[model samples]
Target: MKFVNVRNAVALALAAAFMFGATGCAGETERIESVQIPGVWTGAGGGRVEFGDDGRFELSGIPSDAVVFSFIDPPPKGEKVSGQGTWSVKRKGSIVGLIYDSTGSFAEGGEAGTLGVADGGDSPKLYFSTSSDREYGYEIHKSG
Candidate 1:
């Protein structure tokens, strides 16, 4: 029947919308000095980084210069990666980013890293660069 077909179409539309919105990435967020940016951020694939309130950080399962997520590229194989070090937030013009100086698994050719932060929503947003050109990155939501 015509009514049945229309109802099915409406249902499909709602389902699609729900799936799209379920990603949980905030559309607009800005993390500044005044905003709290210290928390545990879990990667979509596998890994967690803790930004401490005392300008320190501890990482688990995070590889050096990790380009995480199967959607981007295949993750590195072998032993699980871990690291610990200091971190700070720096502002350059309108952009505010988190800079890390770490050791452990992140020591080998991966001493320094930067992550763009955007907070102030229900969750925070962190843009992780996966390439050298800075053309591609992953936008991950804050887990806590």
Candidate 2:
């Protein structure tokens, strides 16, 4: 009777661990899938970004004050500064490459350090960290 009880307890422990591990992995995958980019995103301060399925993007209402420290000569600021370019996702959707149009910041090209879904919202909020230090970024909401 004692041996049978010990074996049952061990089996239960293993089963619990397996279940927990499987659930954890599934949750991570779901989180990644939630960050879909092919849509219009509007930010808090009137900023907007549109990502199309053809790898093209357009932006308006981006703040002029947002500066990238990595650039030797950052783009100039103006009341109406819009950007258009192509974008690509890599590293299993963790990294984003932004190739801006000729008239905007990083006209050559730039990479967003991280991409993820914002917390505590029923609607999906996409967050992109523009700087490696994460000092500058955008939090935009998906449009219906």
Candidate 3:
């Protein structure tokens, strides 16, 4: 019968292209308005955060276990500790807490000084915490 109807029409077109590629990789998340977060942000190891609408903020290469530096235990790696600070944005519906300026807490998150924002369907994400009861974190994006 015509080769089993052409192999069932190629397995129903490969099962409708794998269900539309898994619904475009499960993408659906939107709501990040703190003025949509300032700008410049990139970190995977290189680090970079420059958010300033007026609240002021700046950090480079952050990775000293997410900054807990004090009297020094060899703690100095946010590219020699960020030198500009002052920021605030605490929301709970879509979660956007980034309250810096205290030498630490740029993603400690939820209910402790704060630092966490997400919606990276293609941009926007900043949450860095190597662990300090905040569980663990590291997700920085949004640059260009």
> Which candidate's lDDT is highest?
2
- For residues 16-70, write the lDDT of model 3, one tens digit per residue: 3432332224454234666766788777767787878887777766666664322
By summed lDDT, the worst window of 10 consecutive residues in model 3 runs over: 105-114
Q: What is the TM-score of each candidate against the true structure?
A: 0.53, 0.55, 0.24
- The CA-based lDDT of model 3 is what? 0.50
Clashing pairs for model 2 are: none
Candidate 1 lDDT for residue 34: 26
- Model 2: residues with Cα > 4 Å off, grouped in runs: 1-35, 67-72, 76-80, 105-122, 130-136
Candidate 1 per-residue lDDT over residues 1-144, each given as its tens digit: 676445434533443343223322444435455245677778755777777788777767654354332112233565455667666554431122332233455433223445555344566666555443443254445574
- Report the Cα lDDT for residue 59, model 3: 72
For model 2, how does the per-residue alpha-carbon lDDT over 1-144 read when each residue is reduced to its tens digit?
A: 676445434533443343334333434422333246788988877888898988888888876554222332554665534777776664354334455545565443432223344432457665554443442256677889
lDDT for residue 8 in candidate 2, whole number 0-100: 38
Candidate 1: regions farther than 4 A off? 1-31, 63-80, 92-102, 108-110, 118-120, 132-136
